[model samples]
Target: MTAQIENTGPLTTEAGAPVADNQNSETAGSGGPVLVQDQLLLEKLAHFNRERIPERVVHARGAGAYGTFTVTADVTKYTRAKFLSEIGKETEVFLRFSTVAGNLGAADAVRDPRGFAVKFYTEEGNYDLVGNNTPVFFIKDAIKFPDFIHTQKRDPYTGSQEADNVWDFWSLSPESTHQVTWLFGDRGIPASYRHMDGFGSHTFQWNNEAGEVFWVKYHFKTDQGIKCLTQDEADVLAGKDPDSHQRDLRESIERGDYPSWTVGVQIMPAAEAANYRFNPFDLTKVWPHADYPVIEIGKLELNRNPQNIFAEVEQSIFSPHHFVPGIGPSPDKMLQGRLFAYGDAHRYRVGINADQLPVNRPHATEARSHGRDGFMYDGRHGGAKNYEPNSFGGPNETGRALWQPVPVAGTTGDIPAPSHAEDNDFVQAGNLYRLMTEEEKGRLIDNLAGFIAKVSRDDIVKRAIENFRQADEDYGRRLEAAVKALRG
Candidate 1:
């Protein structure tokens, strides 16, 4: 019987048993119904039914590529992260570009902030720098985040994105004015993912070997240069080629036209954060170049196209709190809130063992965790102690913290942030408006008016214009007139 064993060829069941036929299901009789005893058929059907996982809440639509980040300048004075410790050191990176407010099936050319998330596989561990294309956000605090996303998402009753909901929310939240102005400008609808810049929008803390802390912001200036599509051009493209951005990124990489970004950082001394004219940690604001100039640090190049989109891109996860030895979170309220929220979302959406997935697992080092037995948990570390502090040589903490301690004081209640001089939301937005060329300003006003005019209520439109009016007299006046003309 052993010598005459069958089912040893290329075509076999999942259990390595040979399959005589994969063309059709087994039947009780020659022409009778299919049998439940056909385990192969059952397995195939069951696996196909459960092939998909839950989509992300916010950045649902995205494209991703694998790449390399090579340090060009020594930043050891500012940080001790191993990947950036020495010049010419190269780190494997995975970058995912996404649309902010769209579902998995939504058009890619819509006017939305692109999610630029990078996962660095460093020797210490996996470090995730999750950010957006824009340097500023709509709200400074994370408590208001859900409400802001609700306005952008589909309305419950109407089942569509209502202009009334959008205008109403913006009118009430004055903090949204800066990001709103950015969203309506020419750069909002990028021509392709490769053309626009990426930013670590929130301030972060970088501690050097001597434990000197520096607050920092990150930038990725595309070597391809900035290119954007006008509203009319975007409208046609969104309708005609919904996957244009995704297709462009994949095709560019495949054709050997790799995309690259010149990485830079704006470093501010930790002590100077408090006395700055405006709140430095505010998520809705930015430090002017005149205050802290950007220092070029590295080069990021995306060269490889993902072979399996679902495995490499869709299953990948990132969180802002995934820092290395030198980098840590800042006092930005939004950043603090995200430290919990992003990890929680991934734990629920992906399994707790999502880290074990190939795309998310650390490359150079093993992820030693006591956590065991969750959905999809690969039975690694067999027979090893599940708990730390075992006498049998289990992995233990290194006694050093991954990041330096930040000092804190005062009451811990819901007290608002400390008020700073010139901290109002309108100043930077107004400055941005004034900096635009005459033609660019006209396009921005037109874009704002085109959307605002769709509001059902006159009061909503009036309130919307009032926010921009506070930013700049000319901006508000021009936008109000443009909205009026569009409505008529």
Candidate 2:
């Protein structure tokens, strides 16, 4: 539905403010090299100088592709979201997949959670589903976010990742047990980007036109099927080809072997969620399938490779807060924190009009806002009245276009945050450990020991083992034994 490139006139400053000269820097005198007081030269130089923003602290390395999402099953009863309203409607989408806890230069084959974020350009606007391969996270509360990220990042003293630092945080914050189990599992190191499930780990709210709200968790089941690399294979791949996952994604799309997933949602009614056994809004947990079964919604196919990696993929922005009319966020604390953090980061990195970037812009809807003339304004809203209540017609807010409001009732006072009922964070982890076959459990223990054994401090290693013991005695004992064997 896109038109060919039309003559948009000569390129100018980001604001469409015309520029007569940009090739040479202005100078005090023609013989003089340059002058600092030239505003135009300063604007161009300053912007060009600060063009690159800080890469994500985590999930820094990634690849993206353009695609379309086709509604294959009716989900109109659950969500009024147009992308899933009909059985045949198609919406343009862009999907970005990346590894978390790794730098931009890190190897793609490393054992870490893969971020699977998708931005759908629906008629309503952009809906960004920011998620990961795992269905759960390490922490529940937003308050612990910075401290938690610190452990995964480099050590302040050594300037490198330290097993002791990570374990110290994990053992202390017992809530991380569930996600830790998944991290050590075979799924942690996927063989390729194509062979893994993507989940909206946070429970979100889907509001119907009737104002009914449901707590929803999205699962994009890979049609390529789940495939994982063993530790040995992962190590070999890391050494042989650091960008294995990125290369795989680009090549697949280029060759027309498009990677696709069937979108499914596990939804819980709002009333039931109020009294559910577990905290429905907790990011570090999942709703059991028996309680809320998977409902198929649509299919997402990545059909087009990005023309320019830096312009289209590296600078692209995705956030959990970018919701359209039918979708809204839940009271999920971590999700709430990210709503602010992601947008704030984009503003810092790509400037105020990051949304104007072609990769981030909506496909069908024109952006209308009081915000004008930022670093990268695309001039799409040219000559249109920028202000509301204008003599000349300008875009106005539509009440019917608004999302169905979910009631927000709570005392405005400082209070202890809500915790999940029966919140023994280790139980589900123990269950996961028990479900693993003996061989799998052995590998898990070995993997834990492989990393933990690197810690120089004996106390740190013992403390980490104790944390595992809290989950399962056998788990702790095996890890301790493996560590000792590795030391020998």
Can you write out model 1's per-residue Cα lDDT over 1-488, one digit (the tens) per residue?
01245864587776888787889899988999999999999988998998888999899999999999999998999998889999999999999999989999999999989999999999999999999999999998899999989999999998999999988999999888999999999999999999999999999999999999999999999999999999899999999999999999998988899999999999998889889998989988999999999999999999997778898898999999899999999989999999999999889988899988999999979998889998988899788889978888889889877777878899789877776888997999999999999998999999999999999999999999999999999999999999989888
Clashing pairs in 1: 7-18
C-alpha displacement of 150 in model 2, angstroms? 1.7
| Clash number by candidate, in order | 1, 0
Q: What TM-score, to 2 decimals, does candidate 1 have?
A: 0.96
Could you tell me how far off, in angstroms, the CA of residue 331 lies in candidate 2 after the best superposition? 0.6
Give the Å shift of residue 93 in candidate 1.
0.2
Which regions of candidate 2 are displaced past 4 Å?
A: 1-51, 400-402, 406-416
| Alpha-carbon runs more than 4 Å astray in model 1 | 1-9
The TM-score measured for candidate 2 stands at: 0.88
- The weakest ten consecutive residues by lDDT in model 1 span 1-10
Best by lDDT: 1
